[model samples]
Target: MKLTVCSSVLLLLLTFSFCHGGNIFVFPAEGSHWINMDILLQALHSRGHNITILRSTRSWYIKANASYYNALSMPVEKSIDETFITNLMKAGVQFVLGTTPWLSSINILTKMVDIITYLHSAVCELVSAVLDDAALMKTLEDTKFDLVLSDPCWGGGVILAKYMKLPLVYYVRWQIGEDAHFGIAPSPLSYIPVTGSGFTDRMTFLQRVKNMILYLVTYIQNDVISGRLYQPTCAKYLGPDCDFNQIKTDADIWLMRTDFVFDYPRPTMPNVVYIGGFQCKPAKPLPEHLEEFVQSSGEHGVVIMPMGTFVSELPDDMANGIAAALAKLPQKVIWRYKGKRPASVGNNTLVVDWMPQNDLLGHPKIKLFVAHGGTNGVHEAIYHGVPVAGLPMYFDQYDNLLRLQERGGAKIVSISTVDKDDSFLEAMQEVLTDPSYRENMQRLSRLHRDQPVEPMDKALFWIEFVMRHKGAAHLKAQSYNMSWFTYHSVDVVLFLTAAVLLVLLTSFMFIRCLFRALCKRKVKRE
Candidate 1:
């Protein structure tokens, strides 16, 4: 009887342990972005998986926006905190890593179990943009990642993955190179042409060419720099004999969070999966005050003017221009102004510090969106079938707005042009009253929302897929080895032809010398 009782108790304990799945650790560079990851964690937890987030000891936002003079007040990046380890123990994270830039103490966790690092942004700046700190490179080497997932930020991670002999997957969070974007002109490259303040025009032909040249140079530079960064790191960790490029393509997948509908580009490889809208979820209802405000707008609907988080302060002239434009519009306008509101507030105008964004866009009375063309904002606008008037600031916003325009759902106005009352009014009029824009947005919305799976679920599915397959190598890009000139085989063929020409030229020169000598000998004999 005692033996049977002991056996029963042991079986119960085993069942209890199995019920709680192993740990998953997350490190986020941006605090606000934690929400999206949190959603993913919640879903996993509901499925009986335990997870924990290891936030930066300090905040990325604070570093990004703090006054220059006060910058010294910012906390220096430190070794991993003990709190992170404590949380790891509680959550049972058998696997760990987050958006690259792992904390220095990450090695402590890696010593405990395997690590999976997710690259959200391509480290494009690491090559020529930022100082290549050797000590940082050594730290990356010490992590000994089992798998690396890359997003568009394309720098250090790509190279690290190569050197580490770890599986790599390049995943794009937004549409890469599309032929013609909706709101802007098209480019062959996946990203938009980056424009700086030095440019005289909004976009110049020379600027485009420069951008194209930079694109290729960046790709080559990325590979070379990545190779340099990782080769040494891998040698230190995994020994000197690591086959840096031997990481299989199947082991690395180029997963894009874009659907075929958003980008009409044909898939070149099975590994390059166009899974757009992977993070989208059904938007919930707005707060009572917000809902009432939308209901008050009546049939014409409300125009949502949100410039996004990066640029909350609008110039006085720009604010005045927007207010002037809103006054003329028949629809009620809810402007999410971060700074002071304009003195010329119209009867239909409503200014708030921060509005519930997703909820506001999802409101039935919210017809048109005035955005700064951020990707997240664009995605939210598309998910809600709302047409946008984009004043793209910089980065992917230019390209994102272009795609939205290409879909016929959005319009772009230069801040310089719309900084005046007349232009802002004209642009707002076009977006708000135009039936074509509405139709286009609705059409695209159907495509984005009609996906078989929700974005969060798909993200979790891919995350789990990586865990299950030990690394989805099939999706990695093959262009890693195929250098621009080599990939096209132009340099190799050209080199061979050059060699042949050189050989022919040398033989001709030798014959000429021999012929001259023979003529001289004959003359001497005579």
Candidate 2:
């Protein structure tokens, strides 16, 4: 009877703790960004947090039906639909492949910037929809959310967090125009490379110059173009003087979706937490068909290639060339592509719309990952200790692959060169035969998994920390709010420089007067 009473008391306490879990308002971007954000929401759900996800009516990936979280499906005029994204992907691929005319480079750059501005306009439209709706605003206010957990890629979350007067935590890997670090941390151009620059941390003179130029472009686009799109909303809803960039930096915690293990060593902020491979888990049982395919390989293993979600198909020739190369290999292949079936596809090659990427990577029979070098794929490869033959197309793909290449874990081949002279096969054969690649990746896996606490746990702790304390203001540095002049100590440098010049001038004047007076005295005496 005494032991039964003690058990009941313990159970009650556990239930009470779970019942008090924090309420989180989630605003996420579309496509793979949603994929990453959904994983975090799952973690939050398991911990009993009340999660509310806001999605537009046009989102195909993010549906309103889910058990773990409540949804606010708002009607919008337009969402960044897949057709829009796929066209952008194809255009980017053609540019990277150099198929576009040389003179079109400037046009492509301008169009890309315009596309980004237009997308931000869509986001601002959504933000305006939410803020302008009296019923929705009232409903959100009644919810009394503990904090806003947002993907900082979109400005809507930041604005809403302030509008609701809630503590904001960013689940982020990027801001509008550059890596998130450049926004919140100290990024020295000498070492820290800009995103899409395709230059590593250690750069040549020309590389550093290019990084600076890209930095300027990114800064102007982010501060001017992107900022202007959102600033009007900020003025109307947030405040007339409230700066958009300032609103972005005002986030309480930045749960950065990267780690030094997969990223370059760079300066970081205290409030910016790294949870690189938090989405990864041990291999689960494969489906019967996939299992049979793997078992058929016998001594040979399987190679799975996925080109990420936004890119559903490749050009026919490119797809056929890749398929032809994979067919000749002894290893069985499973490729996630929704494109036309390659004419050269062999019986050994299985073309599927999708496969369980994390599970497949963790399987022992998996040999090499032919990847497009997205952050999710790279981190998953690291988690599963799989080397990659990288075919980087656009965006940060090349840079992500470069990190693995620098560490001797992956090999990258250009899309332009992928089909030329059996380049795809050669790259695949090299990583497959080279034990060093797998060894290097395995070593990285150990380092990544050797953290004191699981990355998810750390992420959870900080998110809850903000909720319990109302905000993580104490962890945020004052330097984040300072201007460039004060943050870099330009004022102090100018003051010291002026003071030193004043002293030298004073000394020279006194010496000249003394010399002239002494000469006059000597003349008078003579």
Candidate 3:
């Protein structure tokens, strides 16, 4: 009877906790955001958790594109200080955030905050800004988060998690980090400076040294600058016990928003979870106009031209060039141009500021993606097994385009020098005619689709697992402690050298002994 009563009490407590356990707060990258996050939000909601979204106005594309010129320039720490705490308080969350800093590089110049400042300059700025905020510390004290989800780029996410006494889980929308490259040999392709294009796998002796030195320099710089900002916040709210270095070292969990197929022949970390295409949901019925457009575009297929959110001001020359090129093609073009359509466009060319991008990508009739090669766009193209022609403008786009070209699934045309007319037309013609591109894409798609679980589920499962297990320390890699020579294990080389030396010594001794014996025999015989 006593045992039964205790068991009943335990069950009741668990039930109560499940019913009222804190909600999940998602702080996404600004201006209402990318496509995959929606899937994550929906998944959380479906799992019976309450969800709140906090996003900044500055986006990933702000620096490169003029549209975000006004928004990006505003200090992020000021913006974050103004909004994040108030929103979290209002939502009554236990705490959760995706990545950190809407613009990390932009915040670096202000010296107001310290942010994780990833590979990009904007990331540095954002990290600097967040570290500077006073209110954020108070908020962390007031409502302690159980976990914080961060974009892999926002190295500061882990920092914030430590400050809040929460577990840090990196959320990647792309490939896994270098530590995770066990199964996949790093490809020789050097796309984005270090992270993109599998460069981690092919890093040479000198490159590794340079990378380590650079990483140490940046880490020290950020730590010192950001530590100064944290001093005030800690003095006011966290009671000086908060050590930023301790927090920096504890980032172990990573939740990737990438699918396995999209990041083929790539390395991954144990903590890294690939959840690309997580945002894909069942398609809603196309709007009447969109349906008619798709239907009218003959079976030869349609090409989607999406420049993405940041590049709103499409040049008239570029539009006219595309229009002129499309007029000569048999395929229908569904161009996503935010600006006015040029007069040169033919009747078959459909111009809209935005279309349901994923739906269009999934469309059976759509064959080509004329893209700016943003990570999201690249993922979508690969998800649907569609070939792409990248009009790369900045950042990782060059790397993404390079990866595509290497895979034989896409072609790249740099916007800096290529003429708007003949060059664009010729590239499109090549992609359309080339069967190899389509075949490679299809192969990738199949691999991506064969994953055992959906990316969101995998993410959530690991998140809950962290909560249940209090950080899977068992799964964490100790590579940070291993020296470069040790991690790669130079002992093998030493062993081979020793074996060769021993063999040579033995052969010399044997030959010398034989020669001495021959001389002795000759002397004795004589």
Candidate 4:
């Protein structure tokens, strides 16, 4: 009887704890954002919080299991068609890396604007599709979730959170984007480089001016152009009273996928949390075949090349050139190639459809990582202390590579310039032979690993903290309410300029009157 009473007391305590934990609703967009969200969702689930995932499709990273409170897969057939996504990805590659031959003749800026228009339309359609789903919308409303987590990249998350009256949290993957302007973080136009500008924090006078112009252009594109596109859809779904401006500023917390160890030190708002390398996991033992290949390399070591999931297939000439370059190296190469096998691949090279990239990089035998400088790849390389030979493509890849190059751990080679066998080989040789590259990477790895809490834990803690505090409104920066002019003190500058002009004008008038009086007195004396 006494043992039964003790068990009842334990059960009561467990139930009380469960009740206190908040219910989190997660909405992950397609691609890498979905993959990143899987990690955070798993962490949150493990911490006893109930997690309900509302995804467009099944994620390869997220398994269907009992750990999650609920998993809802909504069809987005009318929203995201395959052809549109294909064209969008193609346009992106062409705009940034100049992949398509015919596209090379077209004006790059025009192509970029067209691509942005399509992407904006796609996002709007997605929002419409979600809001149109009566069952899904009703289900979401009935859940009465404590908080909503999503990547602001999609923009729909912000709308959903506001509509549901829940605290919104952003899972930002790229360091540079519209999130900076939304008051979630501070992205100074003077120093901090714009997303695709490819400039470093330390910029020359001319570069700083260029960066400032780029910032203005991006702001217009995102806020003015894209905002207009989003307004109608938001109004349609969220009612006419809904404002896009409110959605931009309503985020309660920003979980930025960056850290000072990899990115340059920049000012961030209190609500902004840095959880870089959150996706990086402990090294798992390589498969037998991979282990054998690594062992065969002996002292020369191995190089792992992956262009990420999106850019799986490379241009034939580029692939052949890269294969030929690696063939000459002493090190064995394991490349993730989705296209037809290259004829230039030597006995030392093994091209496969996929690779356990992070695990392979963690292996002690890994000497180099050749990639397109995606955030995940870059952070994984940093986590594993592997130097990079970066061939940056669209979006933040160029900026990521530039930062890695600045940090002395990477060699950036333009995709246009990489067709030459000698140049490609020379770039690879420099990274492999240079002692500074390895040393820098090793130092960064140490620093990245020396955090007070693991990145995943930090993310989980902050997410729950926000939920427990009921939106954590205290963390919002005062700057959130300020306009661009007020935030940067542009208004202050204008005010001071006006005051100075008024004083100067008054002085000029007083002197003119005095001179006129003196002339009148002189004429009377005459």
Candidate 5:
């Protein structure tokens, strides 16, 4: 009787533990990716999963539940200061914005290569710094994590997973790009735009050709240039046997920040899941001052201008021009500006360091959103049925805005147009006055919100599913094992061409012999 009771208790305990949770280690890349990771991590924590974040000292945001959701700050070099990050952002923004005429004239393929090369160098330094910390490495080694979740943008997360001998899951915060290629996802270059290609799904013949060329060039750059950069870093940390390509391809699951409602239809594998609006939540009541400010705008409504975290400030001329334009409008403007307050602030305009962006967008009286065309901003705008005036600056911003413009929910204002001031105001006015913009945005919002499962729930389910299935290896596409040539059927093409050539040669030889025999027979008869 005693033995049976003990066995029953042990079984009950095992069942309870299995039903509850497991250990999860999350390594998020720096910048806005961390914000997206926080949302998922918070959800995981709520589900009783023990979560630990391996983060840099300069992490942008830290969770309130520091004790519960543990963080190990990786020691960075003194040279890796805020100034360094700020300068990098500035240079990147300038390059993408086409502020430098020389850079603008450079071929897009060459520009992409340069961008990846810069990112590769930065990632190597970051990963090396973390690995060099002996104490942190020892602690991580001792911990028995069930799965490794990483934002694979920086190219270090996979290496960390390999070092720990753990299953890797990628929490991709942007549209599928090089990571998809590395994961062997079926991305047909003819349609699927390369990362930052700024092409919509419905492409012209020339656009398709451009897309294909971009993909081929990027593939070569990743393998030839970026691969070499990562090789030494992986060797130093994960040992000489580790291959970066293997580390990338071995990922168990990819939770992409994309939804069919927002993105154009493209082929995706079972392992690649779309969870675009996972960070969005129901709008909270605005703070008292903000509420009064929006209410004061009366029927004309308000416009919210937020350029995202990285672009805290704009150029002096641009800022002054925007301020001047806003002054002419009746609608109240709430501009999130971090630099010197524009001297031309009209009575209807408010300039602040930050505001509750989602809540403000959700407000019924919001006329339009003046955004820098960040994906998160676009998603929020679409979620709230708000039209946008997009001033696209860098990275996928142009692509995101282009799609919105195509869908009739937004208008794009080029930053370098001859009359940018007039163009900016015109776009803002157009989105505000155009009934089609609002109607289209409302339709899109319905589609986004009408998902069978909420994005957050979908993301959570897949995460736990991967944990339960121990990496969900069965979901990986067969192409994951295929070589580049074999996957594209280049080998088959070559073989078929060779066979055709051999047949042609054989036929010619036989015909020649027959002709020679006939000539000889004629001569003998003579």
Candidate 6:
């Protein structure tokens, strides 16, 4: 009787959840970006929501068939894959390896631009395919999704949401090659450093000058590319006057993948909800082999290098040098690498193709993290309170690691000098031996966990909040539709300046006339 009663209760609960569930449409980017998106989709599915993901026929990471969500593919000629990543890594490596200033700057000119330029061009192709498909558009419209959830890293989703006329929510940290905040918020360049500048919030006069120049570079880049690449798509599908940047900022909610614990304090908007470490959860038990390996360390703890999935292998020489360095450590090392075995690798180290990164990081025996400084990795480190010895590969890695270093939870080693000298080894030793690094990271972990609601729950609440209301227009800023002249109050400034100048000129003319009249009266009297 009790068993039947429990079963009936479970069925009723499931029915209730299903009845209240929403239907969501998701447009996601590939690579590590998809990983977190997938996590959120899983949670939404568990809550009994129906999810449909839009993808490219050429997508390498995004799966067509998944239990959590249904997928709709847009056929396209070009796609992003490991080849792009390998080439990008090569260019980035060359850029860092360049000894001469001209050589380094040339890499910046040639391949540095290739990173975003190529990615966006491919994205534009997919966007074109999706819009050109009238049948697909009809199907999407008929479905009548509650909202469009997207990663604005690729601008295609933003354009799609505009076309569908649905509420838009962003699972975002970046937009194109720059941080998304610059597109929406009031960022004072004097203190708020631009993305990829590798500078902190506090800056000297010279640094601020550098900051302004970089900000202009980003502005020019955004304008040139939007006009050249995305404007045509918008003109065709989203109407002639529909500005792409305006559509980007018009997003109803920004589920920002950062919080104050992991990021420096800065200006924010009412619609931007910070959900840093939302992907993180308490550790689960490790696989038997991994647990046994971890236990073998005994009195000494383990050091894990949890590099994200981009790197399959490293150059043999560089690998050997890293292995040699690790060989000297007293602690055991578990490296996640798919490359050929290095000759100098120590007996203390175990390298594998994959790892339960969060599970291992949360282990009591795990002491240090050798990281590549991806956003997910950084957040996981903070969540698990593991000190990092960062090997920043490329893109925003340096900037991400620098934030933690400023907080005294991590130390960065130059990738260029890592293989050449003892820098990598020394960095590892410092983070491992110094208690301050661990203590600081633990403190951050406590602060992150002390919040009333979990970041992930907060993210879900806001997403549902949009769905319930049809949109969050009240929270959105009106600046998106404002022209540059109007948004910055440039016209108002010009008018004010003109008024001040007019008043000063009038006073000057009156004084000159009075003086001249006084002189004439004096002469006549004489």
Kindly state the number of residue pairs that clash in model 1. 38
lDDT, candidate 3, 20-73, per-residue tens? 344443434432233455556556556665544333344432232222111213
User: Which residues of candidate 2, in runs, are more than 4 Å off?
Assistant: 1-10, 308-312
Q: Residues 138-205, candidate 2, lDDT per residue (tens digit)? A: 98889889999988888888899999999999989888767999999989999999988988889999
* Candidate numbers sorted by TM-score from highest down: 2, 6, 4, 5, 3, 1
Error of 4 at 306 (Å): 1.9
Winner on lDDT between 4 and 5 is 4
- Please provide, for model 5 over 175-252, each residue's C-alpha lDDT reduced to its tens digit, 9 standing for 90 to 100: 123635435566766677786678887789998988888877767766764457888888787778766765666688
| TM-scores for candidates 1 onward, in order | 0.64, 0.96, 0.66, 0.88, 0.88, 0.95
- Tens digits of per-residue lDDT for model 1 on 420-442? 44776787788887899989988
TM-score: model 4 vs. ground truth: 0.88
Clashing pairs in 6: none
Query: What C-alpha lDDT values do all the predictions have?
Result: 0.55, 0.87, 0.58, 0.77, 0.77, 0.87
Q: RMSD of model 5, in Å?
A: 4.5
On residues 384-461, what C-alpha lDDT tens digit does candidate 6 reach at each position?
999999988777899999999999999999866756999999999999999999999999999999999999999999
How well does model 2 score by local distance difference test?
A: 0.87
TM-score of 1: 0.64
**1-526, model 4: which lDDT tens digit per residue?**
9999999999999888666667898766666666677777777777777898765452344344545658765555434444555566666665655554655637665766676566557666666766788887898788778999987776677777877888988888531244353345666767887777778888999999998888787767666653577778778767897767556666788888889898888877777788999999879999999999999999999998986454444567777788788899999999887777778888899888889998999999999999888888899999989999988767788788888889899998877666664877888999999989999999999999998899888888788887877788888877656666788899899999999999999999999999999999999999
Best candidate, TM-score-wise? 2
Clashes of 6: 0
